[model samples]
Target: MAEAEFARPIVTVDIVLLTLHEGRLCVALLERSAQPFLGVPALIGGYLHTDEDADAEAAVRRILKAKAGLEGIFFEQLGTFASARRDPRDWSVSIAYFALVPQGALKGAANPLELRPVEAAGELPFDHQEIVTAALARLRGKGAYSTIPARLLPEVFTMSELQAIYETVMGERLDQSAFRRKVNDLDLLEVVEGEKRQTERARRPTTLYRLKTPVAVFDRRI
Candidate 1:
């Protein structure tokens, strides 16, 4: 093989950070600080620091922390993008990742970080809109049979709040009875003792609950 053909491609990491805001799904984006799309909205990303980062995951963690002021978020590798024209600089490949964080966690993040509704997000630089779309699809698909969406909620939540989070991701209204029954059967939640929440519409305080286990993958879709 020709040496030119074997030249290593530039590698980068991009993260689609998602959180729920005002009952809508939102994604965190950063405005590019340098050229090659200067001042344009883009996913939080950077070239992999081979000397410092131990792996792709480590690179993503560093990128999120530096760009979004986020750490210890629940993230998973969504996929990779290697389109020849994706990057204007050179032949590059980006290992894409998606993270879920509770909105409360981002209370004091740094400036230039914007959280826009996923559906209303305008054109993003370098196929980033496509990446966010793929991430949302993965999240919704996984929500059906897994406990992934629970990560978007606080440590303690009411069943109604849990159901609302699922509904927000699924983009549909679920049958309350059926939803509760399915959740109960999964054995994933534990009731919080003597804890309840009262909303303006509710005459009584609703019991609070939390996940009994971190992750749950159901054998059948609920």
Candidate 2:
């Protein structure tokens, strides 16, 4: 007897949610629209198109734009999953990706569903809860040594704002003197002239600083 085609090709996309909320790192969560865990909270994702190119990054980007109507986000491939039973559907393998998008950009008009940001401890639906946990953990690790947090900031912001992002991701408060020391030592930022905005407080207005180079300019290891 000839061998039958026992398994089918499985393609899917998963997006990593990143945002700043209440001076903390927040992740986007959604209610599942279909079965396998219908109505449960999870990250936004969908199936891939077989007819399209095999570029995993591009595929995820398209899904994000189509589903969330967001673009120009800093996305990176976390890894791949091929667990025989990861998906209840006939042995499907998925390429998992994560993204870092500024909070303001999410307000774009193209967005369909209200992508809400979640803070504090909570449970997410499906394997998605695990995916978000893992992705955030990875980003936190990178945060300690890399400038990934800058991706969550505006083009120009105060040093205090930058420090707040790091503290939010790290889930703790940082020392003012030391934090300033670290950023200055890194030499990763460039001060922009003029256009300074004052804060609600009566203290001296903080100067706005912008990234000196693209993320690619920095070593992956930090």
Candidate 3:
């Protein structure tokens, strides 16, 4: 008797949907309904269809929509996870795609499309914890030297709010003076002509600002 070899490999597509919710970095997670991890939280994913092309983008869109009931979102290929023992059921290789969406957009949706903040370290069923860690590192690295961080911000926000978002994502407190200087030098923000009213605070409202232009830089080394 000899060991048997399979004719084909099992391929899967996993999605890591990332977003900023109320100044906290969050990711969309789903509860798995199948075996080998049934009832545990997993990224929205599925087996690749034979009829469909091996195009990662198309596969991710299909999986995201089917699992998360989400569509028309932006995604970037993170990397492939092909460990021989990553999946227990069979020999499976998963291609990971990371999606970034605005917070509050998918709130109260179907199938537990809830957003969980990435700030606190928690338990993730699969290799999702690794995937999330890598994705956040990429985002932080890209934010320092690029304008991708702006995407996580709103259409109009105060300078403090902008800094807060960045600080939260970077997991570090930034020097207020230095932060303002860097942002102003970048000239990426356009001062909106109005101030946001703040009733809770005893001080006056701060001026609001918007992104001056769309960013073309895509280098992930922020």
Candidate 4:
């Protein structure tokens, strides 16, 4: 095989940081600081440090903290995007990841990243729109049968608030009675004793609960 046929691959990591803003699902996009697409909004990404990053996950953590000023958020590898034309420089491979954070988490973010609705984060650079689409599919697909959607909620919340995040991810209204029953059946929450919030029904205060685990998978869809 010709040596030129196997060009050195330009490796990088890109993250899709998601959160709920204004009751809508949104993603964080950083304005590129360098020339490939200077000043353009794109996914949070950077070159993989061969000497520094212990692994791709390590690279993701480093990039998220360095580029987006984010850390300790729940993240998972989505997949890899590699193509000769994906980058103008050379053959490349992007180790893509996605993360979920609560809406209030970014209130103090000092980075240049801005939230854009998943439906309207248009024309991102370097096949990023495709990466976003795949990440969204994974989120909504896993969300229907797991507690993944709860990651978008604050540390403490009412059942209504939790259900609202689920509805936002699923893009449909769920039956309140059935949804609560499923939540109970899954044993996903533990009551925040002595904490309650006033709801539409002023006579009775709604109870608040916190997730019992990071993610709980149920057999049936929500």
Which is the leading candidate under lDDT?
4
**Better candidate number, 3 or 4, judged by lDDT:** 4
Clashes of each: 0, 1, 2, 0
User: Candidate 2's residue-wise lDDT over 40-142, tens digit each?
Assistant: 7667677877678477777877777766667787887877766666777657667777788777666543433434444443765446666777787888787
**Over the full model, what C-alpha lDDT does candidate 3 score relative to the true structure?**
0.73
Instruction: Compose the digit string of candidate 3's lDDT tens values, residues 1-222.
Output: 334753456788887787787667887778888887898877778888879846878888777776666677667788888775778866668888777766656653457765688655367766778877887888777667766566666567778777877777678898989888877776677877756646344288777888776553533322
User: Model 4 lDDT vs. the true structure?
Assistant: 0.89
Better of 1 and 3 by lDDT: 1
lDDT of 4 by residue, 1-222 (tens): 898896589999999999988879999998888878889999988999989999999998888777767788899999999999988778889999999999978754556568899878889989999999999999999999999999998888988898899999988999999999999988899999998888885579988999998888889998
What TM-score fits each model?
A: 0.93, 0.85, 0.79, 0.93
Better of 2 and 4 by lDDT: 4
Model 4 clashing residue pairs (backbone): none
Provide the RMSD of all predictions against the true structure, rounded to 1 decimal.
1.7, 3.0, 3.9, 1.9
TM-score of 3: 0.79
Clashing pairs in 3: 141-222, 142-222
